[model samples]
Target: MLAQTALAGATSFRPLRFSDDGTFQISIFKDLHFGKSKDLVSYNNDRNSITVLNTILNAESPDLVVLNGDLITGENGFLENATVYIDQIIGPLVDRGLTWASMYGNHDHQYNLSAEALLEREQSYANARTQRMVSGHDAGVSNYYLPVYGSDGSSDPKLLLWFFDSRGGNYFRELDKSGNIVPQPNWYNKTIPLLAFVHIPTNASLAAQTVVGIDANSKPGINNNVPLAQQGQGWCEDGTNSNDCAYGGQDIPFIKALVKTPGVLGVFSGHDHGNTWCYKWDSELQLPGVGGGNGLNLCFGQHSGYGGYGSWIRGSRQLLLSEEALGRGELDTWIRLESGDVVGSVSLNGTYGEDLYPATPNDMTHS
Candidate 1:
């Protein structure tokens, strides 16, 4: 029972619900860096990225699609061509009559390009579910949530999907007087489950990699040859040594707020183009005062675009949530490569980190 409202010739999505089979599936396409330029090479890359998206969407038929972040390379765009990428990026979803939501990534902000412009373009499509701040609100653009209702037609929502704009790159017009941004309000019910989507990986996310290494035989996923560009950390090239960068603790407040929140099943991030794996956030990560052993999983979506700086085979991460499994806070996720093969299949539960999963094959490995 998909609900929609007509708004000036465009349909507005409302009240997302699970299927009659009591299941909901979400496909995440992260780092789809489109619109780098109008050159032939860039055009071909964008087309291939779209083909990958179409393949996965047709194969999975997911209930929702998430453009996780870095949807465009803002620095490569101008005011005239910046937002036109939104149409090409969302074309597949619209063609299929599927709905979607997005978060702004580091590269999404630039002197000429902005998250506000992107959101405005996205909202023009009836199936686009991306949201922005109201008149009096001052949070970053794309910081919002959508509720998912159960198949049983109840007024109350069964799950919530939260989207946060990490806010990076050169665009910095909107800011609070205090220079601090609160991603969301405290209006959610603690009893209901929720999942978070943000572009930049938190500091804790890098910590999990050391605890859960990418050993193909056991823990699976590609390892970025370069150091992870975490939140509050500059690019690897900006470091003093230029070879090794240091992590700044500026993102601590956001991490603390996220871990302290209740009913967060998992947090998904995309910034590092070569890293993709999920690990539990436990006391070993060293966020003092923040509860760490709460069965929360920090996962990364596979690099899904050709425009980013990576040779990794493009693919999208798929999450399957069952209405029956929600009570136990269980979720199953895996990466679906462009070749149509599934890898890194793991169930995010109590024993997630210790769990074994298939590794990325040699042919699909990131160079």
Candidate 2:
């Protein structure tokens, strides 16, 4: 088992565990894009985003909530007001007495706003479980893990949750003085079932969408409108060519690590606002060096905020992990919209991609 490090100076944290019924549910709100401005339009959009959060929280009552990224648009943020957006975005979760973890998005790094400032603000709340596990490290502030114990009250954890900081934004603080961007080491044992969350999707995710073709009718999700913007936008793997269609490939190492790791059920990401579908990474479409899809599934969280670009009705992705299901290497997930409708429900198991789901509810027509 990996060493469980408590947040420095943290007073108390709500322990995460399955219920008596052996189930733990998580709701993921991605790309909230709050605090663009204090204008009436931006204010209303932020308000609507909060409403979506509240609606889904009341509906799913998930054991943990994940603010996947882009909690604020840092370009419009000033030093005096940048971190305040974190307070507003987390208000809904705190009001419901919910615990949450946050990941920093590409838009979150700016002159005034940063992952450090944002994490500090989030950690100020007693209910916020966001942690900087490796202090004084440049791996970004949100890199940490949480253990979910079994319902029977044993000390051993039945499930492990991993969070990564797909550091983005204008600032390049993640790089060390040597200019090397350190990759996170494989830290968990293969025995426990693990789930990972990040803000920006990796190259594997983009490759999956490209190969599968993002169509709601065929893929079992809503709003396949925009193309996925990966972690590194320009520059190819060779690190020479700019404007290469092959992508920056900086995230290749991360993707390779995940694909090779065992017990990784699925990787959940939030960045492509218009795309929200889960695709089993096909071995045939694996990138240049990354081998074996290994039954790892790639999923996008619903765009839960009104501040972002997309017009899709706001919603959050819900995940239900049961002890019995974990024994069978299976997971259940879906999108819970603000309208109180459930869509894109499916099981992530051996036969995941082949499984049929209820037709995605009409999202474009509603909003």
TM-score of each: 0.85, 0.87
Tens-digit per-residue lDDT, 1-367, candidate 1: 0112222335556678998999999999999899877788889888888888988887897889999989998778876777768877887787777899998887787666767788888887888899974322334577888999999999888899988777666643434578643122211111223699888877777666664355564457777644566775642423222224465455666777667777789989998988887777766566543446466788889989888787788899999998888888889898998888888888887776676766666344332
Sum up the clashes in candidate 2.
2
The clash count of every prediction, one per candidate, is: 0, 2
lDDT of candidate 1 at residue 227, scale 0 to 100: 59
Q: Give the Å shift of residue 125 in candidate 2.
A: 0.9
Positional deviation of residue 200's Cα in model 1 after best superposition, in angstroms = 0.3
* lDDT against the true structure, each candidate: 0.75, 0.75
Task: Summarize candidate 2's per-residue lDDT along 1-367 as a digit string, tens digits.
Answer: 0001122323455579999999999999998899867799898888888888878888888999998888898778866777777777777776666788887777776655666888877777677888877554436567788999999999999998988877655553345589754232211111223689888777777777766565554468864644577776654555443554446557766777777777788889888888888887766575776765877888998988888786887899999999999977799898998889888988888887766666686465122
**Candidate 1: clashing residue pairs, number:** 0
